[model samples]
Target: MARARICKPCLWTALLGIGFLFIWYFKVLALGYYWLSTTVNAAQWEGSSLWLPGYQVAVEARPIEGLTRNTSGLTFNNETGTLFTVINRPPQIAELTTDGRLLRVIELEGARDPEGITYVQGDTYVISDEHSDSMYWVRIGPDTRHVSIAARSSLGIRIDSVHNSSFEGVSWDSEQNRLFVVKEKLPLRVLVIKGLDVFSESRGFNIDISEWKSSSAASLFMSDLSSLTLHEPTGHLLLLSDESALVVEYAPDGQPIGMLPLWRGFNGLQRKVPQPEGLAVGPDSALYVLSEPNLFYRFERIQKPAVAAN
Candidate 1:
């Protein structure tokens, strides 16, 4: 009987093809897993039942020029009663008074898309560029402006890893001495730094954002949360979504407390605010909302419930 003949060359080629297929399958799976994990961790705060009901007091149309198109980050200084917003397409930080007057504008050229802004102390502020994980500390003086590197870590609160996308919002808790940074969209998480005192000690530190909690993930209702601001007096977080035309207020525990909706009259002015991006609370408790390009809205909080008028 003739011994069974085996095709040695064909067998080797088939084995090589199988090995390549396994490699390709794993490559795609690894990429997909990384994306899925990042998204889940980024938006981990969704489905939180903790939130308050926000009321729509008023919606002022786009009140400024220059801001009509690409507003990214927003912050309010209670001490000065000023609102700061970053217009990314041209990279300009525009300042406005509580009465909706454009006070000043600072150009930030070489900076990546500045997505978040917060006033730390006198003349010192921190800005985050969503395109990169680097954060900048800028010093504004009476006459000259200087920029320095403050914190340079991808230490996002809700992101699963530092390799994910950039950050969007920043809120400083002076009383608690913590910094809260928000990641845009899915698995919305807030990065909390426990001991902010040490932020200056070392360059920066990374905290697992998955551990920090939010009352609600604004992305569930409004998918694109462009910016966030914490109201110290009320412990409420104001979220702005450039795509939803709505601003929502959430409790620290992630509850859906209240919300404010934009009006349609803005279209009549040829300046419709399809995207309400940045948010800041004025000293008077008035909310300042800014949209892309150059549009600003002011909303005074509705009167709180009276206690029997006693």
Candidate 2:
């Protein structure tokens, strides 16, 4: 008889719980918060036209020819005028043109579970080994087709790192003379590696590892950080989140400024990017993104046309 009485409050509570789960699952709340934040902080963009959120998808879901899987982090090589990404499983490095064409796939040796790759300077690049929680400095020359891990410098800090979420992306801030490495999740982290001479041949090293946190960093709403790129010109740091389907830009002071959503309708994307793992910014401020299993996406700012002279 008691079963015949349906408590209205309990039913309403259950419905509310389900609604909340749906919103959370779809990232509606996170996106809303970010949207509100950006709107409220629009004044911060007064003079800067180099905003990340203003980018529109130039190339979407272009398959990297000859590669079928395991394409991760990305970095724009200023010297080569190309892009580089990592393949964790089977461990390899792939170089691509600015428009998503595969230039070459450099066979990587001695790196276990390479998930993130970033170009430091000249022929120097750093690759992050996810499983080992280590970063190795390697060189990739023009005629080079392979990168065998040498006795070069590396930094590994294992502090209760999870199985596969240790290191996800790496970016070199040339202006700051520091390297930024991001952990995938497990309370998503951004770290700054300084004083390590990436080009140093000697055995001695003065490395400093510190967590990068500020008012904005303390409130990063992304579920996971997949990759990161530093805009050396403006010193703006861009972070990519596969789960969030978003690319968020933060000022040098760590203030969140803008965002580019990887959803189907947002930023001229025909379809939501499946899995964005690598992020890079070219000299022209074009954004290059790599998704796992070898898909490439490029986003460029919608340039405003010049007005006629008065």
Candidate 3:
């Protein structure tokens, strides 16, 4: 008997069907990989605690020292009374004396465009890549400084993906034991991560960002919000924006109370503060603001002109 032969139409149809199946299989695989990566990153993020609406306060501008251009976030050490500011482009954290002097510069590792800086338990916490969500913790010691990789999840917050969440401002509430983070713009809101102490104990915490809820009170500065700091003594929240020449103060309930314009000149000195990014309140109730390209301002509360002494 002659060997059976496949028909031409059947052969062509079989080949086409196989090709289509292969294409569909690869397409699904590619999508699955992309989704897996996203899920993994999201699983790594941790959420924050203590959500509150924020408002703005008026600030008087006095000059200070040590901050270079691109200073982003600011935090005050109630224990030491020192102000911490993070310089992005160059990725340097500077400690300033309340008197407007540059005291020390803490060099950071793997800090790609750091924007927020806060001090927790004597260690410096820095948030990097405002456009891309990533965080780092640099421990500054009296003898030697050490750098470590930190995950938002470590603090019980989840990050859905590295590309989804970009954190611009960060502040630690020692009293409440929480970390507050702010996104740059509209839907402009702050996130509170709880169980910070638990993560600090573990030294490696991962939080899911999907669980984070936006603060009903916090609003972005007119342009880009560079940083935010909490006033320990007063429970006030301060917000800074580079585009707007102003710093705002908000209450815990997110009610705007006052506004501070960057003073052009004061004390008979001509001061130009361009791109004010970082803000910190000192123990003496003085406000410290840092601008890009290297400039610091100290605003001392002057008792509202003493009511002209009656």
Candidate maximizing TM-score: 2
Error of 2 at 13 (Å): 19
Residues 73-151, model 2: lDDT tens digits: 9988888888888897778898889888988888898888998888888889989998889888898899888888768
Checking candidate 2 for backbone clashes, the offending pairs are none
TM-score of each model, in listed order: 0.67, 0.87, 0.63
Task: Please say which candidate is ahead in TM-score: 1 or 2.
Answer: 2
Error of 2 at 306 (Å): 13
Encode model 3's per-residue lDDT on 52-132: one tens digit a residue: 111122333434444536666777776676777776666677776665577788665556677777777765454545644
lDDT of each: 0.59, 0.82, 0.56
Instruction: Output candidate 1 Cα RMSD.
Output: 11.0
Error (Å) of candidate 2 at residue 182 is: 0.3
